[model samples]
Target: MIRIENLRKTYGKIQALCGIDLHVPAGELFAYLGPNGAGKTTSIRILTGLTRLSAGAAALNGHDIAAQSTAAKRQCGLVPQHVNLDSELTVGENLDLHGRLFGMPAATRRQRIAELLAYVELGDRVHSLVKQLSGGLKRRVMIARALLHNPRILFLDEPTVGLDPAIRRRIWSLIKQIQQQGTTIFLTTHYIEEAEFLADRVAFLDSGRIVAVDSPTALMAGVGHWAVDWVSDAGLQSAYFPSREAAQAAGAARHNGFTLRRVNLEDAFLTLTGKKVATDANAQTVHGQGHGAHAAATRNPTGGQAKKGH
Candidate 1:
């Protein structure tokens, strides 16, 4: 469970988060969807104690993040957007260090490392150096390390970025498995289909604010079930219809060639914000900070200094 109320964050004159309010119930898979510079990562950094909020309140489970930082942090694990594991260390070694950081006993650390390695299907690769593993394997190892402490909630920022579709699907199954096991997951991702397929509810954040929050199906329904796409002087444009028949009729009436398809989460986001969720893949926050800084800030899960401006 996570609660955020009137949460605001600013860096100089740039406001990364503008008083967004959100609540994620226990055992829910909640996706925060937005293009870059939309405050998605800023919100995660604030919740995980990597970045301080300028104003307002956030709590993990029932503990206030600012007032009860330790308790609040104890309830969550984070898999950052970029791979932050030590390349020199073996898979088992990397996870062992994370367990120690959380103050786990040596025996417990070993047990958890073995169990998580097997859980993530990396049992055979435990002895391999991190640099020796593929990107997908590395991502799986990160997931295992994050779960090393058995935190009740998991914060995944772009969990499947850069992986091929097949590997991405594999990661999706792993994420679903984690949710089914009762961990409340808070996810931020650029992949709209990933959120549509994996999340129970999603929040659309744009220009530092939450524009909409609802089930993916509900949001898609709001925009209609079918879409007719046609190229125009304005580039590509789309029209939504309540049924396939209506969409076909509309497409037939178009002077230009048109394509008919089902409406998707991206359509819902575009309809609401007039922006595509996948725009600006390498875009930075208004303050011009990237995930590299956040990775450095979160390397030590228990405590680390974060630079201002996310």
Candidate 2:
């Protein structure tokens, strides 16, 4: 339902996206995995008409994003990484505003708002101000608002970025539910396990390029079924093995302690890029580095600055 060919985006001397190609079939849950500054958000911005691409083409469903911008945009909903809802607006009011922006009729807006609020399990918070909701509740409200228009595709950019693990899992289940209902989902996240657990297929992006695209299991298999990690003079290190027995044998040889675990999506990414996908320190660093450039690069396509926090 989504297609891209030789997509490129440049911000001054920084090449945010470097001629990448990707396709996500209808009803598929596709994950774009990368560390910050890897062009994941840049790609989303282009697809959603929030920013212009420097070269190449992207289409939603079958409409070209640049040529048929309205049709292309109509096919997708976006839940941005940060909370962008109006703090003063009540939950229902926030969703109602989005529905109206989509030109939804008042009756339809009310119906959809109610349905989506219930779907996201926020039926009781409809009258609460956005600022009064917890982080997890706000995230749920965002999801509901994004779905207010019933777009066929949903783009969740770092959907659970700051939520606790338990809340993240709850959001994960909600995401899965949406996929089951036939929405083609495009997710970008730094959390390795999130992609591993949720995506039917995942693409690893780095330095504005796509290095690999495959099923999570296939990607993990490429790096072996098991991993043995140990602390070394060079810092933490890992070895991949084809089987648990092999991993155990390898670990037994180490004089120091080792961690024996199944090879995961993080291991696959590390093997390919020599960089960790998600770390507390790394997340903080990258989140702080790109705001200025990002703001400068984005254009609303509606004769105004794109909304902040998106």
Candidate 3:
């Protein structure tokens, strides 16, 4: 239940979002992916009412985000890249405060707190301090807090960024559960596997422009079904093959450090933009800017200051 038309965001000479247009039907999980500085966070801030748009229009559940800001915000919940919860507050209290911000009544807030804590499997941590919880647990609390007001859509920005694979998988299951219960999910992730496994449709954003949008399978297949890579004198390069046999042949042609695996969303992005999405494991720089897989260009829409961090 989201619609956008020519959404644009500009900060001084930089155009963060260049006329983006999209539609997300109710209950669909859409993944937005891009290299650093592609304006993913800028779009999210505008959608969540944290920042105003420079131009164009967006509607959430039929409410205009710019014209009807409050109603539009009520239809969406956001889980940011970095954990923003109060460290000193107990898990329940943090959720309670969020509910209160939405003007939820005491009785309704209480019931939602218990149900959401249970929903995120954090019932025992209800009285525990947020700082005392592990990274995974803290992220779960964030999800629970975001859902406390029962928004129609959930905006998850790198939900499992630094978690261990096991904990990340658990959070994946939780996200799927929420989607099954009919909450439209807008996910941005550096982990290609996460989007491949979780999203119904995926969009690739590059240089403030949408390069491609399709189902994961469709995108992957567009490039090919398999990928073979090897270290060469020039540098690392990859080739896409349509079948296991072709990939094997390509691998056999290689004499060193040859690796063959199924094609994934990363390959699709590389094929489309000639750029790699960043992540926490290793930092890669384009020009002089660091775009870790999870780093967002948190530039002020109206100003030139862009603070980017992991």
lDDT of the structure predicted as candidate 2: 0.87
lDDT of 3 by residue, 1-310 (tens): 9898999999998889999999999999999988667888888888998888999999999999988998998999999988998999999889999999999999999999999999988898899999999989999999999999999999998899888778988999999999999999999877777788899999999987889999999999999997776555565567999997898787777666455667778789989998877542322222113112233433234322222322
- The candidate 2 region of ten consecutive residues with least summed lDDT is 301-310
Point out the higher-scoring one by lDDT: 2 or 3: 2
Q: Sort by TM-score, best first: what order?
A: 2, 1, 3
Q: Which model is ahead, 1 or 2, in terms of lDDT?
A: 2
List the global CA lDDT of all models: 0.86, 0.87, 0.83
> Who wins the lDDT comparison?
2
For TM-score, candidate 2 versus 3, the one ahead is 2
Report the number of backbone clashes for model 3: 3
Give the CA lDDT, 0 to 100, for residue 267 in model 1. Answer: 83
On the 0 to 100 scale, the lDDT of residue 208 in model 1 is: 91
Error of 2 at 71 (Å): 0.8
Quote the positional error of residue 108 for candidate 1 in Å.
Answer: 1.4
lDDT tens per residue, model 1, 1-310:
9999999999999989999999999999999999988999999999999999999999999999999999998899999999999999999889988998899999999999999999999999999999999999999999999999999999999999888778988999999999999999999987777888899999999989999999999999999998776655665578899998998798888765666667887789999999988743322221123112222221112222222111
Question: In candidate 2, what are the lDDT values of residues 72-106, reduced to their tens digit?
Answer: 98899999999999999899889988998899999
Off by over 4 Å in 2: 280-310
CA shift at 190, candidate 2, in angstroms?
Answer: 0.2
